[model samples]
Target: MASARKRKAAAQAAAQGAGGGVLAVKARYDAAGSGRRMRGWNPPTSGPNRAITGLQKIRDRARDAGRNDWSGESSTQHWTTNLIGIGIVPRLRRIKSKNRKQELNDLWDAWVSQADADGVLNFYGLQTLAVRSWLESGEVFARLRPRQIDAPLAVPLQVQLIEADFVPLLDADYWPGMPAGNTIRQGIERNKYGRRVAYWMYRDHPGDGQLSSAIDASRLLRVPADQVLHMFEPKRPGQLRGVSSLAPILARLRNVADFDDNVLERQKLANLFTVFITRTMPGGVDGDFDPLTNLPVDWGNDGLPLAGLEPGMSQELDPGQDVKFSAPPDAGTAYPDYMRTQHLGTAAGQGLPYELFSGDIKEVSDRTLRVIINEFRRFAEQRQWQIVIPMLCQPIRDAWVDAGVLSGAISVEEANDAKRVEWAPHGWQYIHPVQDVQGKKLEVDAGFRSRSSVIAERGDDPEQVDAERAADKERDEELGLFTAPIQPDPNRSDGDSSGESSPGRRPDSNKAKK
Candidate 1:
């Protein structure tokens, strides 16, 4: 087969007309006894000229017939026939194999490089390429997608630092009454809330990190620890209070336009607060009264033994010396033996004063008042307590009202009385008539009453009743439910046996015979 194909190819390439055979010749014969007109040529008998003319005529006729046939045929059939005549069939070849993978890679590279050169980053293209590469290579792309590359990831450092510094200060200052043990936790909670507020403020206003931090600190200081925890627990997205509510307040404090600032500020602040609060409290105040101090303490040691005398005890024995013990113990002396002994005594005394000889209760009260005032001053300086207390207290008052602790326009006693009355059933009375009317009852005949008393008393006539019954019987017969009395068939028909016959049909002939 290979050799035959080679030979055929060579022959065709040589171009001596496809097949090796010579062309066929046309057959003709000379006729004798021709009409005599001129000497050599016979006068117009059917000669080669006539024969050529006849052949030309036949060729013209055939061409005209083909044209007519083509015109008569449908356009689709004619096109198909023309295609066949031109040997167009059996010439179609399938497309050659393509390097689709390389082509795709080249297209992708061209788009990416063009974008990179123009400084116009194509995020979608980059993402697609990364995903495609991962799918093809079974490995995640080492390079970042456009979105990942462009996205701001780290929280702002300044915001975080501000939260760290300001929140603790706020807790120390504004919440002076809060025990030291709980301070860290409270501060952390407040920090979280304040950071949210600050985020709202600085989201649009950049570069005021100091002011924003201060506002956050102030808010943190002002927010009660309990309230902060309730609002920020579970630390997931969308857990924060409505931005609409928090944003305006934060914006006013930060002196900014709106709350569309960088989210990193908020996120960093949140994370910082979370970490700060989750950690052990400093100063041994852990939201519970310390058994030793009978004062709020944190999770830290504070140099005071758990079973020792109250914290802040002095070595001086005289009552006057108690006044001299106002300051915290000097550096290394904070946990002195005398202070520890006093702390143990205080703890044993159930937080009562161990000795009246040490100092007057009035003096202690005075010292506490001073500490509170100084803390307030610190808070004010830090700008953490800028909000008026009365305004902040409004929500608590509203909460009380909502919880039904207070009534609207009524005393508590009166409201209680109203509620009781509403729950009691009303309309609990009954009565009966003392007398009844009597008369001769009019008789109804077959549910129809007569206009004349005598006619109604007489009742219906017998003849009319019989006629009505007959008419009812006829109506029932017309409705096909009853039949008039019929004479028996002489043939004693057993009725039609075929189920196709209706009740109205006459008996079948076979039945009549039976």
Candidate 2:
């Protein structure tokens, strides 16, 4: 049977070769074809084209949903909470001079207190706002504003945040003159090599009627690309702009809201206790009965027929009359389950765990929660390292250093050296404090991790922590307080001079007496 199958395959290949060369596979992906399953699956393949045509409407719809819908608002808040809890603080990694590094740090702290161009938020507050905006609007921009040398700032630099609306997503060929190979696509002006040269932005927000009139709204400013920081997570290879994080789940959120409203309306109608009376004969109270339809002819003060029900009150029906109550349709027993499923989908689309998104942890065990959170932390770390740090924090660091040098606060020779920095983002809280701490201790004891690394992971500077610990220890000793001995070196021999024994070693009884 195997030989016959092989012979058949060889004959088919030979026939194909004889007809032409090797024939292309005629089969195609089912999803790519035009069957009923794929009929509504068509989406635009070009990211930039979509941005140019429909980005404004998409952004507006996303903002509307975010502002009005609870789940939509919660998703953006959760992202901001996780990504920029306190701030991604920067540490100078200068090895040549410790004093210079301290000076730079001091200057940074002073400047951070006044980093906002509008003077409304501090550096960390700006971070939170920037992350929130990026999540809600799909993109955020910051212009690096330079101040004079005599300005009352440690560093003559402040960041002015620009909303995504400031930059118009319109395509244009070179503004009619100078350069040949320059064209603007989606507000970003690129040269021949496709490197961004500038961004064409409105001087004032187009939506702010007070800030921009119809006459001044058309005026645009060409800002150098290097002077602006654009923060967004790009989904495609050449996506010029970002689409909202809420984009995928907008329709679902709207549907869920509508469903909730409908359910509430049903409950409201059910509470009215409306009753219908049917009569076999048309004889009843003359003023209360309609002559034509025999329905209620008396109208309430509010202009509607109302049947009032009072406790312990009974009314006798006429000779051949019956009464029945109207029942509004109720959301069935599956309503909660259906809502849970929809909420889970929304959370997943927003790249969040259901437990975090809904604050519903009744069904999740601790172990399961740990797994969910750890997976989420990995994603958060990726965003911190890949997007937040590189795009926002690092550029701000470089600009601060340059501005410091220009203002004579930092030496020109040390400007490049001072720019060597490492960012430590706000750390996550322990899932189970005691268990997590013990696990970390074990890792440290086994030499699998460093104490400095543990400190950094807890959202602290390792060197600063060590220095503070040393100061506390010295103060304790000077006040005649008991100082616990430091842990013995695991690699030290039994006869080591420090007089502390290794783990599990028996203390010398003779030494106690001496």
Candidate 3:
């Protein structure tokens, strides 16, 4: 503690301070009692007082660095690999309604089937690539193109998928020039109502710096909102660009991976076994003699020849003259424990069971696995309905309808009214098939679920199932094939004193023959 004299000296020194000179600080209990603790922070309110926020404040750094990071790419790629498993293709089916017209429904169904077969939805392998781009770069672009009349597309529309790297035509002058109606934010142009009007896509991929590239135009193409579909999961209420799913898991995953690498390196170095040789003779050397230097050395009553370390086998030596071996310290506890803990923590990001990620299911019971997977499936279903459905399937459906109408294949009224369809995503295979089938059968029998709904849940269209059955039956009848043979009643074979017969066969069959 400083005395009063010290405080007075510090105050006097502060008073006598020169202009632009450093001030001496006195260490005390409450030296900063002169309002150093701030109450509330007030941000700047400069700029336009318009209804919409000034765009300059919300500008973010470019996403290139984030996407290119090793850890970021790995986590995103891992999640994408699982989420986009075998590609989530469309299974267009009509949703029956009370006011539904059979002819209109059939028209929609036929158009979808024909368009699917014609490869209208096959936009540069849109099933996998688009999903991968969306997951990796936080968004993807789908631009509608005129279908070639001579091409196999039944509809007059086809799609071309573009990556996010090529679509965001952002520059330093993009956001700040918003009030003057100059540069657009990111690649999206918004109106006075904060509604997206159009996208500014590059004529070619920006990442392509090659001289001999087919796409060389550096100009921006203004594609209207109607013709372009931007697929991304919006994080904020007014978010323009999506943040990558890997953004959160990058550090944790990297730490785990780095830890494993360290352990592995240490283990390898410890395994590099070395051999040390020594001699045990009285007048030969002062200490342990080098065997290479003393080839004619003699051993004095010690098994120095046979008990010595081998060349390429065991390693270590405790004492040069004591004939003892040194042992390395243990590499530490079991590595699996650490890995399992880290994996369990990060597996939630993948929205899958740890067993699926690690391929380890030793402790997973049937019921437990079913519960875990069923819960995880809810996340997949939510992602499908929220992001994939609206961004991908619906846009394609609208385009398909418009194409049909433009080609005079369907009237505008029919295209608009009967265009409603149900998209069934692929279903998961059950762990226990017999139990699952029984549960489904009970659900159908108890009227809790319709047969069509049950079939649809299995990733199959009920109409297709029925049609296939009908065709098979018709073919069998045409070929005069008897599929089922008459079966004698095993329980009542001619005679049985008891109402119920023994398990295998009727006991009275021999009696009846006699």
Candidate 4:
């Protein structure tokens, strides 16, 4: 027997081959009942026309199809929930300098908390909306502006989220009369080095019905790229516009949905009990009952209708008539398994775990789930850094800093570039918290991890944690509450952090005895 790797390779090779011989052999050797031949997969072969044209057409078709179908929004909704959810909102954190510049860090952190309370950042809504937009349309654009007087922050930044479709070409005639080095593709003006200089956006969304009349098509706004933060993960180097996340998997997702719906419909009908009678001795009784409800004298005895056979009441049958009462057969034992299998495929295409996609972890063990989540975390971090950080969070941070300085929430010293910031995205909930914590503790004790790193991993600021601990300690001391303070490992940082063994005690002569 061939190895699994060889079998998979052969199957892939057979699917790619253009000849029938390979397909026939593949079909015979296929492990599953169904062949691997995908529907609507006719790649052009051997010609000038085979250069893979119709990219825009493909994008348009995919978008239209996704909107028309439920799987597009439903799958995206599930992904967004799994990713951002209500608890996964990324919050801003001021990073402490390793050079031990503690005072400035403290000041910056105070300003952060104040600015957040001021609502100048609008970080909450920005993160939620940006993730949704990026997941749905594969891009989200944010325009920075000043906030209203009544806004939360004194000089808070106003972030206006824009959908990908709102921006249009200044001249529809394909980068009309531009210099050789510069080109405006899909409203994004990029220079010779492929650096985006600006974006030409419409005053209002073209699809906004209320503003459609007020919107001036000719009056395009030339916003600098710096002012307009475009968020997307580019698949190709020079690709300007974004294709929808559902674009590639739209067809497969829809097919699976339709199949599931079909199975469900059949199962519903199967559960319904239908009455069938073969009236052998009846000739004059030409009446039938309703096909669905078997109502009183609905098409009485006229026989089965041509349109459809619904479960309903039927007329009385004569004696010696053998009849079989049936509606639809059970969706069968393979129904749920088949759905799980299909959903697994869908999840793979979307780069999500089957559990996350289906929300079913009936048979998944803790170890298995952890492995799956660890893999997904990588994907999540990539999105956070590549898409959210630069395009949304960092820009918002910069604007917020300017607002803070203007509002006097942050002093000039704290407002300087030295007060670096870190955007800490929400962390994960462990499958087994106790076990996970034990492992983390061992990691810390083994000197592979730092206490601050562990706390940061749990979606918290270490500085904040330290401050809270100090406040608690003071409160406890005043109350004479002798609670054991959280003790750090003596060997941590190879014990170079402190000369004393205990971090909780002061370097006093009396406390040295304790």
lDDT value for candidate 4? Answer: 0.64
Summarize candidate 4's per-residue lDDT along 1-514 as a digit string, tens digits.
4699899999888777757766766767444334356444555453322231443344455556557755465567766665564433333344345433455444444434433333454456456767777777767788877655455644555667787767753323244334466766667777878788878877766666455433353656777887787887677655666666766686787687788788888888776766565435346755564333333343325674433444674545345555687857777899888878877877787888878766789988988988998998888778777877777777776776676666665566656563356666776777788998989999988889898999988888787799998898678777666563455565556534343544444434225564
Among these predictions, the greatest TM-score belongs to 2
For every model shown, the clashing-pair count is: 27, 0, 0, 10
Q: Output the number of the lDDT-best candidate.
A: 2
Which sections of candidate 1 miss by over 4 Å? 1-177, 186-220, 225-229, 232-514
- All candidates: CA RMSD (Å): 52.8, 6.4, 12.5, 11.4
| TM-score of every candidate relative to the true structure | 0.13, 0.85, 0.66, 0.69
lDDT of 2 at 444: 88
Alpha-carbon runs more than 4 Å astray in model 2: 1-28, 34-52, 176-180, 210-218, 274-285, 289-307, 314-327, 483-514
Q: Write candidate 1's Cα lDDT for 167-231 as tens digits.
A: 22122323433333332332332243334221211122223344443534323333332232111
- Tens digits of per-residue lDDT for model 2, 275-313: 777777544545566423456677879997655556886
Please rank every candidate by TM-score, starting with the best: 2, 4, 3, 1
Against the true structure, candidate 3 reaches a TM-score of 0.66
